[model samples]
Target: MKRTKKERQQLLQETISENPFITDEELAEKFQVSIQTIRLDRLELSIPELRERIKNVAAKQFEENVKSLSLEEVVGEIIDIETDRYAISIFDVKEEHVFARNAIARGHHLFAQANSLAVAVIDAEVVLTAKASIQYVRPVRLGERVVAKAKVNEISAARTIVEVISSVGNETVFMGTFNMHRSM
Candidate 1:
């Protein structure tokens, strides 16, 4: 028997509330609907996508506690740091991070993770991504944990260049160079 739209909407809300990190594909499968259908439902409900929701939550949490770093804002946590120009972070690839088949994470997540690390190393209150170049070396499988290390390669009066290296286990999965600008 087919369920009504209201029933589907209620089910979606319950599922999302229980696990806000679930992917659209997973929800589609669970609800016996198409991924596009699920997306439409989310749009109709004024619910942001998984990434946006995560960012919002991170922003809210950060606002509440200014002392703590918003790891979720970058979607990764700093594991180590060397002065104000270098740091390392670790992130796990989950369903919410995947946009396509297999365990490959969305490119934006990789970019954000690297960019956020570069920004975090700055002592200023505002930082922006000026430019970036990223190369995907290998596919990161779902549930695999990866490490991201960034270093300040060069710094000028207005901008800083940072290099990021990401690896899954011992194998290098992605690498990036980010140029960040600090505003006064």
Candidate 2:
């Protein structure tokens, strides 16, 4: 059934609230509407573009005190985070991220997303990945969005253990356990 403009606009707000880093193209696909329609709805609703949303989020993350590393260095757009606990980031696979032949994303991109998230979750002045145990569950193709969630599983004065899971939609595509060293 086709949704009325009001319903679609309401849902759009909710969706963007949940994932502020979402691109207009992604929104168009999700809402099954034209990109121009999504843009018009956004303008009507006073919603900012994806770049602006990300800038706002980057500023907010800085305010939230992501101490270990700069927000810019992280592999994806971090949507939710609290240092020393958990963090969630979104990575959208594009042409450059995937192999030319099969359009499958390279393993290191997912690995970096998880590893950097693990570092970002640590409460420290300096953080480094000492070791990592990672698994690639499936191949992620072009245009897919990978959401990586990092949770600190253990901690000490000098070290920390974080578990990161990267998923495309509901399917797990990558998993990593990172042992990080932090300066006290």
The model with the greatest TM-score is 2
lDDT, candidate 1, 1-184, per-residue tens = 8899999999999889888778999999998999999999999998889877655654554444323245456658665555346777778888999876666788778777877778776655677888888999987777888889989888788888889999988999889998888765
Off by over 4 Å in 2: 1-58
Clashing residue pair totals per candidate (backbone < 3 A): 0, 0
Error of 2 at 111 (Å): 0.7
lDDT of 2: 0.91
lDDT of 1 at 181: 85
Score candidate 1 by lDDT.
0.78
The residue-by-residue lDDT of candidate 2 on 10-102, one tens digit each, is 999999999998899999999999999999999999999987887688669756788877878989888778888998899999999999999
Distance (Å) between predicted and true CA of 7, model 2?
20
Q: Estimate TM-scores for all models.
A: 0.59, 0.73
